[model samples]
Target: MDTQHDNALTHALAAIPGPVPPSGVLHVVIPHTSRFTVVGNHLAQHAELSLIAIGIAVYIQSLPTGTEVGIKALTARFPEGEVKIARALRELEAHGYLRRTRVRLTKGRVATRTVFCNQPGAVLRGAVVGAVPVVGPAVRSTTPAPTLVREHIHVPEPEPVAVPTAVPEEPRPVPEPVPVREAAHPPVRLPLRTAPTQPRRPLPHPRALTPELRQAASALLADLRRHAEELVLSEEAVEELVPGVAAWLERDATTDAIRRALTADLPKPLKHPARLLRHRLTALLPPPLPGIHDLAQPRRTPVTPFQTCDGCERAFRSHDPGHCRDCRAQYWEAA
Candidate 1:
């Protein structure tokens, strides 16, 4: 730093919103000032120094005297240095106080470095022209331009323009009228709305089963009937077992027929032993065949009979076995 510049910095620091005493003064009054002013200027008193200035001073004091310094090198002098210094330097650059450039060394090598100084006139002009001032009109123009003038001219009247007239339309000829004839018979009257014929409801019919599925189901029924006693199947069981058996039989060589057969009867559960047989049959089938019997039938609540219970002296609706639940329990206890 130049001695005269240092002296000027000390003077500016004194002018800051704080009290400045002589060099040997015991106490100095410090005032709140923006960080930029504190860091950029030097101080005469201890209170005049900002925390950042103190930190920078300590960093500079640590380096050897007369050492050539660059902005990055100066910023990195502290152990806790970070990219923030580069950012602050950028702000300083925007203010025209800092700059970066490459310089050729005496050893035929180039070195990149940052320099700090007051902004030049051209840079200041660019900034002032760029910024739209808040107070008063801006001092600079947006672009360079020369003053210009425009002129108007007067002329004498000349010849008048001619106007053309439109032609008239021609008259149209009249047409001859045709003769009319009367109707032979009087018009007939019909009722406003005719009654709609009711559509015939579909007739109640036996379940539709494909020929191949029916044959397979028949074969399964024959097998089940042969072993009915062992399986404990009744009439209801026969009805339920047929669809599942059809699906299982069609699972391999006749999957398409089985799919057609089982799609509507999906969700009817098989008995335990029959379910095991179905599983074995599924394992023997090829890939992409129709799924096994979906024994999951839509749940229906059993109809509850409305009855008066003699034991409980209450009317209740129930799907329970012959005796009401309470009576059944009491009878079992007495037994």
Candidate 2:
């Protein structure tokens, strides 16, 4: 065994290169200054996680809170297709790095909620992330680690000396006392949160909406997905949002105008399609067209009534019935 160990060590020493060449991959790492996310090496270099899964995890971690992370949303955002993204998401979930749940909302609606863990193991152990490495591209280098050699030296032992029997002990001063902190209080119990008293926004009266306007509004809401895929609403959500869109139309808002208003400059990673439309509809509602009830009626000029001539029996404009202008002239001449 000793001979084998010596032979292996001699081979390793002889194989060490004297001149080190530059590696193909170089890291000019500049520490991130702002808007950065911390990822764990365990998850990044997972023994079982695929490359797609790691990339997906990093992307999700970098997003702001409450960002939509549905499989469809991710597939649309990334170059990967639906099947591959779905598979990667499942891989992440299997290894405890991702959690997906179907949350029941206040209404009878179910929403998909995604949660990401930067350090799954630490989370499982009920501890905070202490020393997880930041995310970076891993490069394999061909350079080998340098070997070290140590020299050994021996010296004679010296005779021990005996201690004096009557060595006097020195007195030590006590340290100043530190003020102790007060006793800790019991943890406060948080009160249960109640549902919102006013969840729905005030909408225009339903009676004001005509059948044609409702149909147009419903069609507009359903077609929003074409302009912005994130605005895709479920049937129930579309139904709930139709009235609000109808309110916009009741005020002389055209579908094109409303579409531009709702779809223009939409927020990134839209979490709630219905909620955003409801807000835009209510907030951007145009004032109803000028109606007689809304505006003062115009005053009409007084109009004179036509009268029949007494002598000529011809119709003429006068305060009372009289001869026609030609008949009046003739009558005047006769008088």
Candidate 3:
């Protein structure tokens, strides 16, 4: 959805109270008195920065100082994904408005700290900020500035040269120190990894399963070929997935159910047979059945108490002793 901030034209439109006039924008903005961050036009309107970078800078500035602004954190907050967010962050860093540094902490912990600068102008880049001394730590050696001053002092000059002593530099704004917080993910109620970078190792293979369970699981898999030729699995594939099918058996899911889960609705071409079986085995594996005492009672739908309509004595489900709608309509037509 698009959003716009209100301005003079929007206020003028409201005063004429007819159908709204056509314009390119409709404003719905309320000025932010609280929960707002100050952003300089230099960063916000930067010619070199991307739209993503500009928006991210605004978001980072609005967050509390220690809030996570790392690639992962921003990726979560925005839909632009890791690559774009990382690129935008690089843009911000290159412009001197953002910085990321990896710090090693106690107990083998390493963290990346992110900092945002509001106005990182050319003064910090060694060029003086117009006429004012901007109080930054003098990095004289890096620029040959102090050496040039000394050379100028030694020059044989007839007239006294008054080099302006005012060093127009602000205090070199150090990157803010911040502790990194890891992103939180909930348990089996949710997936441990929301997005896996690498394909997960196929579920605990047949080796850990008992001989009896493995034998049964293998039989079920081998039987799938008889039901559908396309459902064929290699001996190695069967061995690999024996544990997964065994998991279903352990959950008290029947062999027939497992077969149905695997073979039903086979797609056209049915190309990677073993891969299909593996996916079904993992995804459709039933949860363990509860003990008899904990088993859910069969749900019974409530039967509405049948009522006799006053006009027709017809059975209906209302509590009031009133004529049915059809009979009422008939009487109105007669009148």
Candidate 4:
């Protein structure tokens, strides 16, 4: 009845107009034997094995043998998430439609190979047993017959061969032993001595802040405190801020420019001055000057560095480093 129904469905599909083009269409062959086995299996009717799981199994079976099967590949071929494909593969394994065996490859590498079996578990097991020749052909041949037939068929026995006894012989004479030799001189011993230890010295302090650096730091702090009185910078905080500000000066940021950047659009009742100041100084820093090599032999076109434009905050490459071409032109126009 199922075969007739399948035949009718095939005919109905064939009668439809507009046959698919042969150029890009994929032909997947599903064996008639597999159709019955898969449809009639109890696992196929299971609620956990939904249509999605069945579809995934059929797709895997359709793939060429030894073809790579992975979550990423499945997701690309099927309109499903990686998680769903993984779950479907697990369901197929549970139902014995799929088996994954881990194999070690050359170069000490390992990979998993998926095995698709359309037959039921019991039939598969029986086929495996039948393929192996572990038991002798005689034993296998006898086990399939009835017990009475097996007993009656083994009546003939081979006659015992005549045995030969050994006679006693006379004893032989023993041989003499060889002599041993000793070393001529005795071994000598050496005396051991203890090594002396040296005293440890204290590490030197880091270089002190120069007077110019101190002035810049004081000016920066004064500007910050004036604009935002809520800011309370301890000596440690000042020490930390000094080096960074000094480095900015070395990079050509004037005292006034640094002051403007930190004080721009000050928030009333500032809650976190150190964090805010750190972000402004770091974000508004200018690009480093070109190196000596770059200046001496400039390329026809300089290799642009990756940085966020100060004006737009969008990442772009530019020879100017901090500003992209569009924003740089805008700045010059405004000036």
Best by TM-score: 2
Give the alpha carbon lDDT tens digit for every residue of 1-335 in model 4.
Answer: 99999998787667656775667744444447332322335445654566777877656544544456777888988789997788778767666567677889999999876655543443344444443222111332322221111101221123455658867667555432222221122222223456767553222111455787677766777566765566677777766677667667766668777777877787887877776766666667676667778779545865767888888988897656578778889999999
lDDT of 2 by residue, 1-335 (tens): 99999997777655655643566633334578666666668767866778998998888767655567787788789889998788888887777667777889987999776666665554333322132322222222232111110110111122355756886789667543333332322332334679768766675545567788778878888898898998988999877887888777777777889899999988888898778877887777787788776688778998888999888687778887767889878878999
Tens-digit per-residue lDDT, 159-239, candidate 3: 445667896888786643232332222221212556658765566343357888989988998888899989888899988
Q: Comparing 3 and 4 by lDDT, which wins?
A: 3
lDDT of 3: 0.67
Q: For model 2, what is the alpha-carbon lDDT of residue 119?
A: 56
- Candidate ordering by lDDT (highest first): 2, 3, 4, 1
Each prediction's RMSD to truth: 43.2, 24.6, 25.5, 29.8
Q: Rate the local accuracy (lDDT) of all candidates.
A: 0.44, 0.68, 0.67, 0.59
Report the lDDT of model 3 for residue 264.
94
Overall local distance difference test of candidate 2: 0.68
Q: Could you estimate the TM-score for every candidate?
A: 0.20, 0.32, 0.32, 0.28
What tens digits encode model 1's per-residue C-alpha lDDT throughout 1-335?
69999897777676656555567544334675432222223221323333443444433323333344444565666554555444444443443333567889997999765443321233344344453212211223334321110010111122354647768668555432222231122222334576898763322112345677766665655454343333434455455556555545544445444333323332335445444434333443334353445545667987878877778756678655355678878999999
How does model 2 score by TM-score? 0.32
Clash statistics: count for each candidate: 6, 1, 10, 0
Regions of model 1 farther than 4 Å from truth? 1-72, 118-335
